[model samples]
Target: MSKIASLVPESLKSSKPSLIRVLNNKYGSDPEMVNLTVGEPDFKTADHVKLAAIKSILDDHTHYPHNWGTPGLRNAISQYLARHFDLHYDPEGEIFVTEGASGAISTIINGLCEPGDVVLVPCPAYTLYRINAELCNAQAVELETSAPDFKVTPQLLKEALDKYGDKVKVLVLNYPVNPTGVTYTPDELRALADLLKNYNVAILDDEIYADLLYEGEHLSMAKLLPDQTLYVNGVSKNAAMTGWRVGYICGPRDVLKALAKVHQAAISTNATMNMDAAQEALLHGDEDTAKMKAEYDRRRKFLMAAMDKIGFEYTKPKGAFYLWVKVPDGFDGDSMAYAEHLAEKAKVAVVPAAAFTKLPVRYFRISYAASMEKLQKAVDGLAKVFAQDQAD
Candidate 1:
């Protein structure tokens, strides 16, 4: 008989392995390695949240969850947004939970996009957006936002809009952005919103790190353009509940209903126990997140000062736990090669900027999500590497 094998999905067949995971797997086993490569939070999920999950399981609430999530969760999310972002939605009609922010992005892109549509993604961004766009058969057009500060400027938006026009269906954005710790000011977002309002593109605002801001007030674009914004967030980053796999989508009724169908088809719903835990986190974990943020701020300042002393140029982080640093001159500017060399010589690991870019740029990101002790060690290791390179 002839050998037979299942065909892989075209998307998966060509997809490159996630560089973040690859680097972690390669360096994670080394005893002396200080792995600053991944963004996994060092904090444990709050005790009350863990207890809620346990209580749900003991109370026999482990059956299949509602596709739109539990009433309590949806209502809590509505209230959370209203209180923080000053944006209101009907929990019954506009909220839908998914496996994570990644799942929610998949649901929205696959649900909303048609073949040949363009999804505008800002470069040096979270790589999942580009991968998701490719999987959905839409063009993931990246506009590089590295020059003049790492932000999506109004002029850049206009240039892309003029070139792509109605073919653009969705604009994906993440602030307190991954890789680069830069975020937009409210006035900056409002200017982009003014141009966006004239176009028919919907906004996918991924605000998973909204609560981790170290400077400036966090603003939701949905507050400025609610009719066209699909707000995606979760307890993963804020409450250190990443393994819980609970995330959400809030938007206008019609579009949310469409996304719900995709959500149902993809995973039905996230686990009931996880949803219960997420509800508890959302309802009462502000203190837990606040404490974590304060510690992260301390680490952030320490890392920036250390980088300056070591002679690496870095953008001062505004929010989130990552520091974006430029490859110093006199070194070849291949971020992946530079990162690997650092890991080998200094026993410190950082993610290469190539992982997050759709353009050719030289940068790398160091995550401070580790403890202050670990961050200090990593910085010391990095300093040794820089000094060694200069000597060589």
Candidate 2:
């Protein structure tokens, strides 16, 4: 008999291993290593939220959940968005629960795009959008926001729109962005919205980190273009409920109704208890998020000041937990090697922004989601690395 093996799809087969996870695995065994890489919140889930999950389980609510999600969760998400973003989504028709923001992105991209359609992903960004588009057999076209300041400009949008035209199916916009920590102003988003209104592209507005705003308010893209915007949000970052695995999508009723098929095919529903927990968080965990944001703000300031003294170059973070740093001049190798070298010499690991880029670059991202003590230790290690760079 001939040997036989299952074939992995080309989209998944060629996927690169996550550099952040690679480095974490490499350096994770060290007892003293300050892993300033992953953006997981260090805070505990609110007691009330945890208790809700526990109560649900004890109350025998562990059955398979509805494909769309529990009515309570959809309603909670709708109310949460209306209260916070000044956007209204009908819980009955326009909202659908997903596994997480990641799952929701997959559902939307798979549902909205046919093969050969283009998903316009602005970089430097989380790698998921591009990779997911590839998996869906859709083209992931990256528009690199100009350097020094990483905000996407209207002219850039115009150029891409002119080039790709109707082939562009989705425009991904994630603010308080990962790695860079750059966000948009309401006026800035409005400018982009003006251009976008002319195009037929769907706006995939990812607001998973909306509650972590350390600077100006978070203005949802939906606020400017609700009809065209597919709003994605969740309780993971805000409620310290990442392990709970709950997210939701709010958008046009017809689109959401169609997307519900993809949601059902991919993942029927989140666990009932998890949805219960998530709704509780959405309803009552704003105070918990507020406290966490205050700490994250303090950590951001502390890291920026410390990096200033130590000679690591970066724009001041506006929101979210990651600080994107351009590798100082005279550093040897690309950011992956730089990161590995740092882990070996300084015993502190940071994610290379090279992982997030669609083009070549040399940058690393430090996550401030760790405790102040851990951040201080990471800073001390970074100072030594910079000193060595100067000496060399």
Q: Residue-wise lDDT of candidate 2 within 1-392, one digit each (tens)?
A: 33543466777778777666777787778797988877789999999998999999999998987789999998999888888888898889899999989889999999989889999988888888887888878999988886776878999989998998889999999987887888999999999999999999999999898888888877889989989999998888998888888988999999999999989988888899999999999899889999999999999999999999998899777988988888887986988888878888898988886778857778889999999999998999989988988998
What lDDT does model 2 reach? 0.88
Please provide, for model 1 over 1-392, each residue's C-alpha lDDT reduced to its tens digit, 9 standing for 90 to 100. Answer: 33443465676667777788888999988889999988878999999999999999999998887889998899889888887778898999999998888888888888888878999998888888888788777899998886436889889988998899899999988898897888999999999999899989999999999999999988899899999999999888899988888899999999998889888987888888898899999889889999999999999999888998999998888998999998877787598888988888888999988899857778889999998888888888888889988998
Worst 10 residues of 1 by lDDT: 1-10
lDDT of model 1 at residue 58? 100
How many backbone collisions does model 1 have?
Answer: 0
RMSD of each: 1.5, 1.5
Which pairs clash inside model 1?
A: none
